[model samples]
Target: MGELIQEFNDYRAKMNDVILGKQNKVINRLFNLDTNCYAEGALSTKTKEMLGLVASMVLRCDDCIKYHLGKAHEQGVTTEEMYEIFAVANIVGGTIVIPHTRRAAEYWEELIAQ
Candidate 1:
């Protein structure tokens, strides 16, 4: 992995472990819920991930955007599909999300290069 991608993943995993180690019921439950929410159901996992990516971008959460980008990539989201998702996010989020889109594009590149 590129240094940027490696650093992000390593830090996220380390922090997640530390956060979950606290064993706070609320935080654990939230984490569990988030995991379950992406499961196959009414919507396919791929579709769910696309939605998540869009929402994360709009919310301007870089970590979340990265997480969803990884998931979306695993789902075999095509470059074309990703561009559409980016368009939707930009339209909904306005120019404020352009900076985030730039980061997301960089992250997706790392994922693709992998």
Candidate 2:
């Protein structure tokens, strides 16, 4: 039991570190306050989450996809809603992004399982 608890704690710590690093990279490098329009936009939190998820899917960013997907779920996005967003992403970004997003989703499933 102690071993199991330690393993879980280690997993949580690693996950937190990875997520924080990814967020810092994105926010600092990609989003410049005065120049980057994503920072100026007044979109609703839900809309922003949806757009971020779509962008992650299109860009084949696995870490971004997992983060945004988790955010979307926390913000009350349903599976059907995510599917619709994916349909739009596929239409906009082509077939390649679809498989990438699917792979990211699978990765998330594996993470949750562990």
Candidate 3:
């Protein structure tokens, strides 16, 4: 894995373990919901991840964007499809999203490079 990707995953994992270990009901439930929501259903996992990526980008959450990008890549979202997702986010989010799109594109490239 690319160093950037590996570092992100490692940090996320370590933090998640620490956070979840605290055992707050609300946080745990929210985490559980997030996990279950992305499972395959009428919308495929790839489709869900694509939607997540777009939403994350528009919302300007860098961590969410990276998480969804990784998931989207794992679920076989193509580079072309990622561009379309980026377009949708930009259209919805306007200029504010451009910076995030740049980061997202860079992260996606890192993902593909590994």
Candidate 4:
């Protein structure tokens, strides 16, 4: 779990540098879109992050899962909320999402511990 958190932080740092240094304009625009989408509104950032996490699970996107899990944590999402989101993901994604759900839960637990 510690290693998982470390790897996520490392990946985030590297991606930040790469995006800011190399593909500044293009990536910045995408980042802007992300910022706008996740901004506080009728649903709150926490809700959006939870939705994003569920979508990531359904899409089987490991990187997106990690990123959205972190973002959700930042927005103060609770473990119970994560469970509900995982349930939704599992239902939509079928049996294939079981492992991803486990992975997402582990990530959420690690983030909370930190």
lDDT of 1: 0.95
Q: Model 1 TM-score?
A: 0.97
lDDT of 2 at 35: 29
lDDT computed for candidate 3: 0.94
- Window of ten residues with lowest summed lDDT in model 1: 1-10
Candidate 2 stretches with Cα past 4 Å from truth are: 1-41, 104-114
Flag clash pairs in model 4. Answer: none
> What are the RMSDs of all candidates, in order?
0.7, 6.9, 0.6, 1.8
44: Cα error in model 2, Å? 1.1
TM-score-wise, the better of 1 and 2 is 1
Q: TM-score for every candidate vs. truth? A: 0.97, 0.60, 0.98, 0.87
Regions more than 4 Å wrong, model 4: none
Ten-residue segment with the worst summed lDDT in candidate 4? 18-27
For model 2 the local lDDT of residue 24 reads 88
